[model samples]
Target chain A: MNSNTRPVADPRPAFVENPEQADQQQALGRRIITDGIRTVFLVGCGGSLAAYGPSVYTLDNRVPQLVVQAMNSDEFNYRKPAGLGPTSIVLVGSHTGTTAETVRAIDTAKAAGAESVVSLTSDPESPLATHADLAFTDRPTKWAWDPKEIAMARITQGILDAAGLAASGFDEALAALPADIPNVFADLDPALHRIAEDLATKPVTYALGSGPMEGMARAFAMFYMQEMLWRHAAAYNAGEFLHGPFEMTESQAPYLVLCGEDATRPMTDRALGFLNRYSEHVHVIDSREFRLAGVPDGVRAEIAPIVMSAVTTRLAQHLEAVLDHDLSTRRYMFSVEY
Target chain B: MNSNTRPVADPRPAFVENPEQADQQQALGRRIITDGIRTVFLVGCGGSLAAYGPSVYTLDNRVPQLVVQAMNSDEFNYRKPAGLGPTSIVLVGSHTGTTAETVRAIDTAKAAGAESVVSLTSDPESPLATHADLAFTDRPTKWAWDPKEIAMARITQGILDAAGLAASGFDEALAALPADIPNVFADLDPALHRIAEDLATKPVTYALGSGPMEGMARAFAMFYMQEMLWRHAAAYNAGEFLHGPFEMTESQAPYLVLCGEDATRPMTDRALGFLNRYSEHVHVIDSREFRLAGVPDGVRAEIAPIVMSAVTTRLAQHLEAVLDHDLSTRRYMFSVEY
Candidate 1:
């Protein structure tokens, strides 16, 4: 069993060193501004696309001069938005640089005369990288935070800086982010174990988050719980929870709320409050608990999604241990052709 | 029990006659283009906000010059995107025109110097309407398609017409849409009854859709199943289903696929194909079954969501009957304050 499956008293997150790479991340954003790109499409399949959620949300709020959207790679290719040519930039991601749909999306973007097609992938020789105008490749990591999200943030920072809307201390905070992520696993080990024990045998579990944290919540419920552990799970935007899904509160299903420090935290809190009163199985995985060390308070909320992503990953691992399910076991994913 | 609860041999959907109203719907869209409103914010709470999903998707694909977004009312009020200024327009909705968050959002929009704030609600004297610079109030309808969606469409049409990207026969299609919605109820009753009978006792259910049909899929799972029927349910974008949630296919949970006739239909088909193979509990609710008379084939896919919304609403009533659950029965919605 992996160390993640077995809790240590003084558990330290296993660290995988991200190899030093050329700083090609910011080139996409810089080129976007230089080429007068009016629209930016962040496209990828599954979790690869999810990696850009927070960055897209932040860009939508911070840089109005640039219209930024995160779309599923398959849908983007099929619909092909009217704004996708000449003055547009398409940023896509795939860990192995071999997601077929994403590769097709990049090819289609290039064919449509998009000003730039940028890819973030681990394999420099992969089609996604070779087919794009520019590519940012790094060593693959287990968790999505390091190479993928960090590269996404850097490109985002470039856009904000170019538009004179850069968040103060954002660069330093992001640079220090990877080093601090492990600390979250160590700190939350005890809490995660307890929560996982409670939820292990539950037939269904839910993850909830709002604003920038929504993508991570979905990754936790759908990817980590359902996909990895083969458990029935789902995620909801905390803002929309009360509108419908909260009616299941009396079902006693375990609920985990990713309470980030962003402005949408209150939306999370409201749903949390309702769930807390109505159901006993409620866990709040707040970003405030993370030891981000020197990250400024002003930018703390901005990066909360990254920290919270680590927390969910650890929690999923704990659940795997308690449930005695192998994380890599799947019935149909790579086993069957659709 | 309502006729919806007990399937009629020839189920005719109950129609509430909508009174004739002013043609003020297109005014907002016209002003937006004339005043150079570059950003459009469609804001509302719960299902109110969901009603704008297809319109927003269509606009996003059709109008590159306009940045359009559908945001939860509370989150919109809190984050108040940096783009909310004299060049922006905010369109909000609330059934009773008193959704506190939506009203406050309009107030905040005005305070931020947004070019205009338009309110679409059923109450002309409501705060959401009274606080806005322009109000399009209509008689409330049982289904969201009539007054709410039609008004939303008219404004979208106005924008498209004004921007010179108008879909031919769109106005005629929308005007004729409400009259043909009941035909979907008559056509789908038998299929829905079989599906509901199979799903009535299932502990969990899922609804899947892609692109323009996504919002209705969500409404089916979250609003119809979870809230109204008090069933454990969730909705997923068909495009993203393969990424993670498809792992639950082996569980044999009841699956409902909202197959719209849009470009994204293939994405839904891919998931439906897998689900049909692995899970016996699968139902396909195709929008093509809806007879939208006089609507041209060119715009049929565009209006698929509106038709599917009616189908899901009718199916929910059937579930309510078979499950012996009152659609209005709720433990916390209006009973307790958060």
Candidate 2:
């Protein structure tokens, strides 16, 4: 089932060679703290937004004194947060460096008097990166998410250190990712294929995850299940699933619960317990089942989404196998032009 | 078409008579600011989460000195934010005051050494109200939402006053709701039926809105459309809609776009521009179309969700008419144990 589209190898990040930009970002982080900056807005769209999921999940724990808000790029362009001007920094990311909403958000942030506008994109020549006050570029790849994860970890640690919270930083934990990320694909789970086979026949599918893993589950449901396979699917936060969306659960309802190592495991376990009673096809992708010996326990809790992403990527591949649907097929994405 | 189960009469809130609780809530709000509270956690689940939409939308615009984070009750219970205890007040509201997750969260906040636990619920006997350090109760209603809005406005204004930012408060503006709210149903919208009829047959529907109205659109799609009619519908914030859900849009795909008059209108309008190209069955519930003459221009931009909710209530009734299905019809709600 492996095709040319499948990311077959681990791609190196371009930023590794460009240490100057990394230093500048760290300096910007220190400046924010020194200037008494009250807010740090992390803005992006789609996969770019999901890229920051881990940082969003872990930043507060590392720097409780800092206020961080993750904003959808377009939302930030319109609903400019109060005091977002000279007192704040707008950190944005786009893969192609051509995501219109993100480019516009950078312009909007500058106009709103933001002290700094920083961007992360794959294409250095792309407007999203070229027009920013500070921009970091990486070579684009469909399957490689480690670059973004590393970039975010660096930025997060910078801010944490500037806030005098280096003792609680995640630098060492993130450094272990280069080795651990590759190991996620070394051993394949056959249950991933069985889950895909069950979901291929179901018209609607739901994904559930706790804390950091929630965003990864959402990306799988939307990007893989819906966009890749053209299946009706959506992801809900574990706690939210216990609220109204749980009503949709029925006998044989297809559900993929991403159980990661986190403080919220009890909540996800509770949700899974209830889901077990309702659906025969309820499948669990528990990180506990995996042997991620390269990653430390402390970092394991935060990077659960990255691990889930690696597993779901396999599920997406297997879905292509059983459904006989090409992962590249699309009616509207790049075809008819929506 | 209105039946016995329908709430045809306008239910006035009991808060008008019970001003003491409101006064106490105001004092708590001020104390939160005066005591140098660094974090304000707004927590709830389901409709109660939507109830805080406007405050969540407009609070930062008015009170830049304070930090506000809206959290799901269950999520808060497990993944407690780093700065949640001692210096933070968990402001929670539950209509029935007996939701287990929210009740558990109240206990969690107290256990975490929260400076204050303030609650707003209708059932005084419920543990949520009884166990709170300060609790405000309103008489229950099936359709009315003004009491919560008024209460939030008062609490928000008190916090603003303490922070020396009360000049931008909307207390008087929200007071106009009891008068303006009744007028929403005085004249029904014909477009509501047209939208409902077009949506009745679709297997899946999407609702999009910005800011406060985002929550309203979500409630209309999930609670009203899915829960009441057993139709598949979901809502996305305008910016979020552009990210991934837009991939689902196709020719004739039914969409209900809630165009509210707020700072985020441009964002929603941008999304609508793209949705218009993809779906012919796009429907707009523009607050600008309403004659909300009683609502002041200043506050009209803030309460678009409340206005949209009024029209959506009408749409719910019309959907029952078009589908020949009762709004109360449910496969398992209250009838089956989960």
Worst 10 residues of 1 chain A by lDDT: A8-17
Q: What are the RMSDs of all candidates, in order?
A: 3.0, 4.0
**DockQ for every prediction shown:** 0.75, 0.47
The local lDDT score (0 to 100) that residue B212 gets in candidate 2 is 76
How do the predictions measure up, each by TM-score?
0.94, 0.89
Q: What's the alpha carbon RMSD for model 1?
A: 3.0
Per-residue CA lDDT of candidate 1, range A82-168, in tens? 789999889889888888899999878988898878888888899988988888877545434446777787787777777777779
Q: What is the alpha-carbon lDDT of model 1 when measured against the actual structure?
A: 0.80
TM-score, candidate 1, first chain? 0.92
Q: Candidate 1: interface RMSD in Å?
A: 1.2
Regions of candidate 1 where Cα sits further than 4 Å from its true position: A1-22, A140-145, B1-22, B140-145
What digit string (tens of lDDT, one per residue) describes model 1 on residues B1-338? 23345532232233333434335667667767878888999998788888898888888888878889889888898788878888999999988888788989988898889988989888888998898888888755533544677778778877888888888987777667656776667677889878988888687888889998888888788887888887888888897888888887864578889898888889999998899888888889888777778688889988788777767777877777777677778877777897
TM-score of chain A of each: 0.92, 0.87
